[model samples]
Target: MTTIEQASGAEPRGGGVEHVDVLVVGAGVSGIDAAYHLRERFPERSFAVLDAQEDRGGTWWTHRYPGVRSDSDLFTYGYRFKPWTGPSIAAGEEILAYLDEVIAENGLAGYIRYQHRVTAARWSSGDHRWTVEVTRGDTGEQLRLTTDFLWMCQGYYNHARPYQPRWEGMDRFAGVVVHPQRWPVDLDYSGKRVVVIGSGSTASTLIPAIAEKAAHVTMLQRSPSYYFAPPTTHELAVTLRQLDIPEEWTHEILRRQYISQYHWLARMSFEAPDELHTFLIESMRPLLPEGFDVEKHFTPRYRPWQQRIAIVPDGDLFAAVREGRVSIVTDTIAEFTEKGIRVGSGEEIPADVVVTATGFNLSLLGDVAFTVDGEPVDFPQRVTWRGVMIAGVPNMAYMFGYFRHSWTLRVDLVSDLVCRLLETMQAKGAATVVPTLRPEDDGMQLRPWSDPENFNAGYVLRSQHILFKQGDREPWTHMLEHEQEREILPNADLDDGSLVYR
Candidate 1:
């Protein structure tokens, strides 16, 4: 067998080895979800969790920028097992609290090793197990663990440093520059002119919030993003809670409605582009002033949901714009000037602070390296089997959420699949389960896994060629809708010849 390593930092092997039936690599929502199912499914098997961060709430814990909250409803984003007892759109702190509640309620805290960052994993055919290496964040010490199954719940991005483009004369600009990813708690933007770059969720949410305190806030966008202000609390969700209805039933009903509307809108965006675009523009009409240039400022050049539909809670962003505290400049940024940025129109926007809300750099499995029998596992060379597991990779799977829908919706289903997969392996006396492609599959047509034309987010477009591709059929297509995932994950035949057990 060949042995390779992408993990580093050597230390004395001072402790005895410990083995487990499963090693879940994360402590966030996905990791906690996986652990709960594993414990319930295999009561006798040993299991543990590892997380790189010191706290729970993966992205929720890291992104503490002003006005940072969920873009979707809490009912669907929250766990199905536990109902969210808070607002429909919750802040980062609230989500973290909910995560803590879940961990405490399930007694999963004792099983998680926080600050333990996993760097590499290898599958050994001879041993039928994986050797994993983790580096401690507090100390530089390295620890190794062996597991029969490896579940990757560590999300899909580099949160430590977000994408920062080099702006010309940025160093010479006499102003504070900050990315929304690393927001300083003590930052005082009051009475200062603020220019926020990008029209994505971060900028959309930040403009109104900072405008409340700043002298003026301008959302500088190269192109417009589709946005709509959904209610902060769904009237039905609130009514049901007040009427003493079981949240489970109410939430399930809400889930179906939300999913249907989302799917329908997405279908309309592709099927009838002009109609959908016109409808969306009309929807934004009441939010702005009567004579506002809604077409030029709010109307996007592309169809809705192609990237993402940014949501503002309760029309707060629009209110700020109407109040004249917030403004929008639709133009390309030429470069950074001494005071602010110069636009392609030859006009300069002066600001005391320039916030770059540009977005993240997509990195899979925390940028960890993997291998099987000593050969490096190049992900771009692989195809995403069922959108969760990979071909030729045994006893391993990563929970990459749906791009078109809420991440938790798909991850919840994936966690269930992992539990089901583990149970099926045990019942059949199997040591390893790997998805195998059929001989006929060799001739099937395929496309780039995440085509920019299909899912055109900046981070996604930049890294689509590096991700796993898929064929044109089921199990290979990996549909992104939540309804499709919920329907297919449970009832699908486990021994359907594509997933092989040995």
Candidate 2:
């Protein structure tokens, strides 16, 4: 990681006071999208995008482990406004380049200030503004900026640190141990016996890529996760390229088709878990050796869509197993051994290097402390307004993409909502726009954001209490389905009694 170089002149004219129409926190994908959408309507609105990271790409910049790529295809994950002209499944560097192009082309580079981590935000009812405190990473100096609106686009995961489990005998391991999140650029795993601990997408990607050079790679999983091999190239996109259709229209059509199929398959899995289960198993039978029990290594105990299926471009993982480069060990790690790891099955997986591709640490609103009118904001006590804004949080909207579908899908809708809300407020001559719950809304049933039935991701469950709840019904609950959110968030009346415009 590069050191954050502090820019000269911290304060503005010997004072920390500077005002803008909006102050955007975190210049990740969501923040970039928010800036683009806001620029579309309110180009004149003075806003700044602050990022804690030293560079442009947020998660993409953070995780540089070998074969780090999108969990979903880029076509869907890429912003709705900006079509991903790259491969369907793009690598981290490719995605980072895409972000760079978006920022450069749209003139967003100047507006973004890196190494400025937002610490606290206090909203004042009298001023109708947020006084946000940001700490410069290089210098210990703290700075303040006041803005009419606060857009939290920092994403939902904790990037400051990776979630490392406290395993027995971790300190005794002689060989190089690394988490995929903090992969050392100079570290070498060439011809080394490597064991990757986890079966999620990170482990899936790392094993195959490392197996090319490593003498052997073993993906050690507690159980199993559903695996799918999507074609590296979008066939529809390829076909459209041969024709005279504009890239924008072609991209839009393909995006819609992919999203539609996802919704259909997700519904089908719930309707007939048995049928889906059989189909998933049958699909991978040919990929393995004849009579190989794919059910053991590839089949997940839970139904589909419970957790996202681990995807690899063009069956890379399956091919690796078939070619005898990588192996899957579905057993719990008893403990980390000095030599390697000992499994619950009394199996000793000796390795020279161990990579823990465990999942991320969940955090809310970039884990920044928030207050309104001197009262602390408890997210769990508040219901979401279209799954974007917390009810009663004035002039504030945080972007949390769809867990079921590509995150960009929901972000697009929420960005549209933010632009429209701001436009409506300006038109109505309103200073404050808070999602004020109606008397009837007070009686609604609420559920945890990390509910197992709704979202079964492990990290989400860990930070459930820190997250905002969803009601049993609309505007309050997040319609995890993209089509549902697209229809609801964009079309909902801005003047509805839910939002108090004062």
The sequence of per-residue lDDT tens digits that candidate 2 reaches over residues 196-271 is 9999989988788899999999989887888778788888888888897788888788888888878876787778
**With candidate 2 superimposed using the best TM-score fit, by how many Å does residue 424's alpha carbon deviate from the native?**
1.3
Global lDDT of each candidate:
0.83, 0.83
- Cα lDDT tens digits for candidate 1, 143-244: 787788999998877888799988788998999999998999999999999999999888988788889899999999988998878888888787888888
Candidate 1 has an lDDT of 0.83
What is the clash tally of candidate 2? 0
CA lDDT, candidate 1, residue 61: 79
Q: Candidate 2 — which pairs collide?
A: none
For each of the candidates, the C-alpha root-mean-square deviation to the true structure, in angstroms, is 3.8, 3.0
